[model samples]
Target: MIKFNMAPTARKLVNEVMAVKPGERALIVTDSGRSPTITEALAQAVAGAGAELAIVHMSPRLMGGIDPPPHVSAAIHASDVVFLQLSYATFHTDTIRGALAGGTRTLEMWGFEEEMMVVGGANVDHAEMESISLKLTERLTRAKRGRMTTPEGSDISFSLDGREGFALLQTAHGPGEHCACPGGEATICPVRGSASGVLVSPFCIEHKDLGQISAPMRIEVKAGLAVSASGSPEGERFWAILDEAGELAKNVAEFAFGTNGACRKRVTVREAKKAMGTCHMAFGDSQSLAGEVNTPLHVDMIYDRPTVWLDDEMVMKDGNILI
Candidate 1:
């Protein structure tokens, strides 16, 4: 495999985004299935910053939201900063919650490819993205209801009442704060049993069988649960995962829009979900983001150019931020 120079970005993460202080403990976590290039670069950056660094490797998890090994969890809790470079996301697991609650700043970098360290969303102006994300987050926090529609015939509405919006600014500057690398979304969890409508998406992120969706998938949601999914074989595969995971897996868990200007179209799902003007909805395991639901699964479906409304105000129209 070709080696990409990840040193620059890794240093940025350690020094700028994470702001590792001298003598602070920093941990880099990865799994067997993931490449170690990024992890090594991160370790070097941490050590170069005068921080005590630890690197751990384990077997890959079956899916997102699964917990790490006990020792790894312990290490995470002890660290001042952690970079999760696992094959699958552990963002929703109790381990992460425990780490965050203990004042460990974490950065989720699951499913990240080597090329991502050099280009794409990693090149985004984080400060500008943070500003945009915060603005949109504030709007979502104040709105009682939200509606999303796409040209592909999606129309979903949900109650945002009492929901707090989150901004993924790609930084973990303070204790107890966690963010995703290449993150630039303004997201919120809808009330349980409050989402109802059809959701159409061109593609979904990370599945056992379907990678990039072969065809547009239409999901029917009623009372916050995905009642049915169709329109492609990929849809059937998606429904199967949810059906097998049990009832809680079908909950309409998240509503979010991309904010990173550096993201390109038709890239990896990890980057695509952060592409400006795009939007996505997720199913299952939202407690990490302060939602009521919890499940072993967390999957996102992405669609392009959506018109979004908060309460009676149009916040985004045809992928443009109207404010």
Candidate 2:
């Protein structure tokens, strides 16, 4: 059994950690490689939360496979909340999806947050992150009234009045990595991993200037997918990465509303966009681990300036939500 120690980062994760209440159970699921670190920190965290916790720890080494066992079913059934982590050599797309799919209806899942962390980021201020995340979610759910678009480049454009214009979208299904698999870059789970962006139509435009942009591009979304994109290599590369994900590559999967106000881009995707306090959408992978499974392709498009409308109500214009 690998043992994990509590460091400042671990403490921070727990500090902002919110889960089901006392007497309720929270399960931390992960691959064997991440089990030690995750389990250790979580154990300490859960105890502090006054929640009962149990471990159904599984290792890929024992079976030479990554998926958790079907036999582990009973363990999860007993918990009120399921805290899952996948910090391994990636994971079998199927294995990850199954766990999420099976748990959603089964567990209460009262509070859920998903995001990718790297190089042991212990500096994350959990409270600040959660505040940002919740604020983004809150703004998205509000309704809005907006202009129109006839995606698919149709002969006519219809107004987005009384339609769910912008939403915190999750693949209405399970996850498959390729959808947003940016080749040659370090990645988190390709599927439902991060609560990164609140999805926008390729036709929708959101703009922001946190640090710099050689030239910010304006890409177009049609039918919930990016059809036309124009910008620097960084901007276009965002699309190129998805193009390689295969057919249905541009099928939008997840839309995350970012709130990591403190994170700065590594000047590379792995360190950048995912941490931005804005909104984004993925084309291919829909996370199954997060209980969403639909498309195999998940690509994310970040919004800098957006006007959001849910149904016929106008909620946000240029990053500020009326809610």
Candidate 3:
């Protein structure tokens, strides 16, 4: 087997996706727990693209969606483009929202490992992935109701009224645009108080320490709130975490489909949720994604081979995209 280098992928991110021009100010926000090798590759790539580079290292946040320090937020707003190379996600935080609103192009690489740069999703054709994502986004935007079911007993339905779908693609060169590295998903916020039924997840990405749960975690939702959790010890722990996070944490927030064919099954959270034919549902912090709910946490639950329906149209059948 040949060893793959990360430099080429880093270069593609800087020159192709972000389109960092000469004299442009590029900022890289990383944390102590993140991979230094990945950060350095991105830094070198930015420099080679003829952009002024600045890197800021901060203590990692305890959970996803937490805000960074004020100075870091300030630096993000001041830059032309920013690379979020952190251990936990800041994509749903007000800090990133402010920066994007101020015309800073941001790329989120939360929980990204060095292996992600050379293999898996990053190794795929970005343009083809983007096309798949955008097409699904269009279908989602036009949908008013959606339902999903997995072989492991996940059956949930939610209204998509007035919601717009967001396509997570690699290109984010324009002002106020945001994307994720190794991105390929179409996501939308479900209407508040409109989700109900059971959500059974084979993998809870937030509790990655547990890895693939021995039993599927089952969550019962009523009126869009996850009323109770059961089915396994992991499910109980998941409920406890949400209970500790306050009432808003139980709100069913996001419904998304993975579109990256090269993404592996059952890997890290960032990559697993992008695996083609898979789907993930998230709870908490929908404000940044064009929804009303805002909470201290955002967690995703991934399940395999789901059959999904959007307004009577079968978009996915057993994890295969039909459209």
> Model 3: runs farther than 4 Å from truth?
1-4, 207-211
Model 2 reaches what TM-score against the true structure?
Answer: 0.45
lDDT of 3 by residue, 222-276 (tens): 9999999887888888888889999999999899999999988867877888889
lDDT winner between candidates 2 and 3: 3
lDDT of 2 by residue, 1-323 (tens): 22333443333343333323577666665554453554566667777777777766654322111234565545554455555443321222454445444542121111111222223112345455545445545443332312322222211112222222122111111221111101011112222222222222232221111123355554455554456545654456555654655545554444444444443434333223434433444455444323244443333444444454444555445544454
Candidate order by lDDT, decreasing, is 3, 1, 2
Tell me the lDDT of model 1 at 136. Answer: 96
Superposition TM-score, candidate 3 onto the true structure: 0.95
Candidate 3 residue 194 Cα shift, in angstroms, is 0.2
TM-score winner between candidates 1 and 2: 1
Per-residue CA lDDT of model 1 for 37-150, tens digit only, reads: 788778888999999988989889877777898998999999999999987778888899889999999999987888888888988988899999999999999999999999
Model 2 residue 6 CA deviation (Å) reads 3.9
Compared with the true structure, all predictions reach lDDT values of 0.88, 0.38, 0.88
Ranking by TM-score: 3, 1, 2
Q: After superposition, how far is residue 307 of candidate 2 from its true place, in Å?
A: 12
lDDT of 1 at 86: 86
